[model samples]
Target: MSGMEGPVLVVPGLNGSGPNHWQSWMEALIGARRVDQDDWTRPDIDLWSARVADAIVAQARPVWLVAHSFGCLASVVAVSRLADRIAGALLVAPASPDKFGITARIPDTPLPFPTVLAASRNDPWMKFMSAARWADRWGARLIDLGEAGHVNTESGHGAWPEGLELFRQLQASAPAMTGPLQD
Candidate 1:
């Protein structure tokens, strides 16, 4: 849990994580790389999914996903495509695809890798029950973060160290993959 074997892919939500966002702090603290989306404000589900998949493909080593908001949805979509490359995932404050006026694209099947879905009780983007439903469907563990307001800087969490702790727990519990790292 203390040390992960591969690159930590930091995926942000709308407008991308600002310099002071927790995801950015994670990058600074653990040397994670951001999944670059072509357009941050206007999120296209397919495009975001593709970007996540591409990031995994580019990595020779195993990749651990640290995704927030809409990025969590994209990472979920990309998981099946990059299952072998993913070590585990931390999905924080997932923004329901339905909120964007699009029909849900979430898959019904359980994810290939172990995952944790962190939900905020008072997040405007999604209801806690909806997140719990998603966790059930994806077979992910749901962690309730009470009244955390989307777990963003606007919610008073510029550096969410607790999220890092959750990632560590996931890593510790996940089964080890057998293949050699790409480098």
Candidate 2:
């Protein structure tokens, strides 16, 4: 499993995952730990990235990141520093950094570990094409989830069984390359 033997880390977006959210449901089903950001509603990209790094280092076992919306941006930034410890990542419905008015530069460096980016065609946070472009830039396998709004609780994704399957896919597959796949 390489460094992929640890518990999954569930990272939520914006205001944090409510109890009824899919992320919360994932936490229970997969025994995943939520990266409890110090500030949830108002996020500082660097701070969130640091928190993710801290979470990865704190774990004795390997870690797989499950990040949704804005949390996806944070994970990508943190992975630049902690790629050695990551097994894989599942990024779902990433929000536009510009929309949130986050000034911190989103890293364009391709991630070292295996990653799957799931994009919803009808997501309000970002255009599907933009998300697909990001997936390509990050060297992640893109999964086009047609018309699934935001893929959040409000999007009627309380259980998100399909997402769970995608997460499992990441676990089963070995990283496609060693070190960063591309610049």
- Top candidate, metric lDDT: 1
What digit string (tens of lDDT, one per residue) describes model 1 on residues 1-183? 333677889999999999989999988999999999989998988999999999988887778999999999888888876787888999999998798765457776788788999999999999999999989988899999999998998998798889889998898888775455553
Output the TM-score of candidate 2.
0.90
1-183 in candidate 2: lDDT tens per residue?
433456689988899999989999999998999999987988778889889889988877558899999999988888888787788999999998888676357877688878899999999999999998889889999999999999988989998889999888787786432242232
> What is each predicted model's overall lDDT from 0 to 1?
0.88, 0.86
Residue 2 deviation, candidate 1, in Å? 8.9
Instruction: State the displacement of the C-alpha of residue 34, model 2, in Å, after optimal TM-score superposition.
Output: 0.6
Q: Which ranges in model 2 have alpha carbons more than 4 Å from their true place?
A: 1-4, 102-104, 175-183
